[model samples]
Target: MKEFDFIRTLKKLSPLPWERTVGNDSAFFKLKHKRGLISKDILLEDQHFFSSIPADALAYKSLAVNISDIVSDGGTPRAFLIGLGASSNHFSILSALFESLYKYARQWNIPIIGGDTVYSDKLLLSITCLGDAPQNPWFRKNARLGDYLYITGTLGSSAWGLSKIPTLGHELSDPHIKRHLYPPLYLDFPSLFKNKIHAAIDISDGFYQDLTHLLEESNLSAVITPETLPLDPSLPPEAKNTALRGGEDYELLFASPLAPSSRRWPPNLQKIPIAPIGKIIN
Candidate 1:
């Protein structure tokens, strides 16, 4: 199928609010009251993933990474624009990709509005996700001196999975490698935590590095007890070191005054494991 044909299928599957005029010069989106947020992420062949990875997984990751950004700011994704670069014979792969993309869009209630496509040497995808914030969005700069530093889900699991990707040959069934290919999404965090969180960020660039970003933005320092840090039980000692430096986990790291010990999370989030790794220090 061609680009236009695939786009038409997307409109049929999950049409955007303004998709009636999508085929024109540009797409249009409008919202009242709530603030709009947008984030873009570029995934490339070899640089981001091996060619052995399946197209559907690639498509999901492309959209999920962008959604991670929206979630970090306490927002709900509304729509997305996809810029695809691939060769002629990639139509079948593109079909599988669109199927996965549209499926996730419907599940998230977001639409694939519009984008540009071109022929490239290798498969390249750039996704721009747009979202709406119900209230004031969280930012790293808002962290308070006494705020607790927390992480949702496990860290370094993705790195551990990445290490095995070369040996396992892009196998998604393996639990370890699967984490690298499909990082967990924290969409419910914004809704569950609500306005309690003062600052937030997605751990796309590993724990320590992204933590540094948070601290830098807040003009504060933090003390993270290595022993308290959450590591995958399956990871070896060597993997622990890589987990701190490795990237692409997509887990959320937020600063909040809410005491994790005193509060009981909703039953649905108990399985995800939210833990305090450290506390901000002036």
Candidate 2:
């Protein structure tokens, strides 16, 4: 018997939510919330992202991608509702996926309010993240030309880790693999929440592409420095280009006046490596 996939079957259901490729908000009602509107994207087989990845990994990836939008917009993810399609065949994997969602949701202090489940041929996860800010959310347009440029963690580490699984030398733990498996959300949104961060985003897509959203929205330009960027130490010289351009690190990229380098933060943000990747020029 051929393997059943939830996503494959979910797509075949009658009255698909999306409308003809023009202007469509037919499924908008499903996104309603109290403090903020909800956002969701359904992934069918071979769609959204690479299809060959594991189900649990896919579940986390689905959440990461959706939350990235909320993080970039400076909203605290209050909760999420995951719509799942998993048949008996994939139930184990699907269970692991939802379990991971609960893990992350709890870690982030967000709730898994509710969702729908259905039988499907292949796995499909339609995740919706809900969040809001006091004022209008942080956006690509708020970047100031002279504001400081900053980012969290090294660039391309996730992509690099996946491509080159480092030799597990005397190491007992697998944080690196876990990182690839479950991309971490910094949650230290001081920049956005404090209004101290000027231009900000999470590196969900490749760093090279996503930053453009900020520049274009701000009607400004940028100049990234080769040295200041935090790249993976394991990356050879040949792979630097791909690492820099290949996003998905999901680290935060925001502009703020130098954070307190004098003292340490409980879980601090470093000042180094986060150099002037580029300037928002007038």
Candidate 3:
């Protein structure tokens, strides 16, 4: 079957509100009353790149940023589109970047159907990934006051690692360095929903910003215990505050009630284990 045929068969109605697709062949589907419009835009600059980052990994990171948003809402990535800005001197570097994109694209079984390019003095790139939700996309606003909160991985290390340096120009290749480079993507979210989580959202900006989104979405307030939040092992004792507020961890922060047997929640779902850091209240 054609790719479109495969997509058409995947959509299903969920209890949450969602926009209807005109057809699977269309370019993008919009939010009728939903926020999960596909093709999320993410921008990057020289500061965002490192000389040691492989093009494949850069492409993966670039693409993962957008895909993270879609999948957090239970959307399936269908393809990608890019907006490129670079100079004649950097064409080869940029070329390798996109080559890296295709690596994950193939791993993800997605397509790069369209994009635009322009000349600039330096590098600036944006990736817009198209994804579809089988059910209504998850929203941060729906977090209820009594719901239990969870995160897919530890926080703080990505920025924490970026803040520190090594001697003799040797880059650290430890877990913290890997966390800084490639964050854990919650690809197994379908299994997470089996436990009846109340509402969900992914952490993007910083914990404060993300938690604000959850409260905004649910129309509730939360009191999170700092000590209970998952912290990176590599974080300096002082960096604990940064982990609380530093962003770009890209892990899923979701809410669920304590299950009859919380034991059933997957072992890989969290790095530090899902602790009830706070309670949603009016």
Query: Cα deviation of 220 in candidate 3 (Å)?
Result: 0.4
TM-scores, all models, native as reference:
0.90, 0.73, 0.77
> Each candidate: RMSD to true structure?
2.9, 7.5, 9.1
The TM-score measured for candidate 2 stands at 0.73
- Best of the two (1, 2) by lDDT: 1
Please name the candidate that would achieve the greatest TM-score relative to the true structure: 1
2 against 3, candidate with superior lDDT:
3
**Which lDDT tens digits does candidate 3 get at residues 213-271?**
88887888877787788887667788886787887788778777664256755565543
Between candidates 1 and 3, the one scoring higher on TM-score is 1
Residue range with the least summed lDDT across 10 consecutive positions in model 3:
10-19
Q: Give the Å error, residue 107, model 2.
A: 3.0
Residue 264's lDDT within candidate 2 is 26
lDDT of each: 0.80, 0.62, 0.64
Given candidate 3, what's the lDDT at residue 275? 51
> How far in Å is the alpha carbon of 211 misplaced in model 2?
2.0
Q: CA shift at 68, candidate 1, in angstroms?
A: 0.2
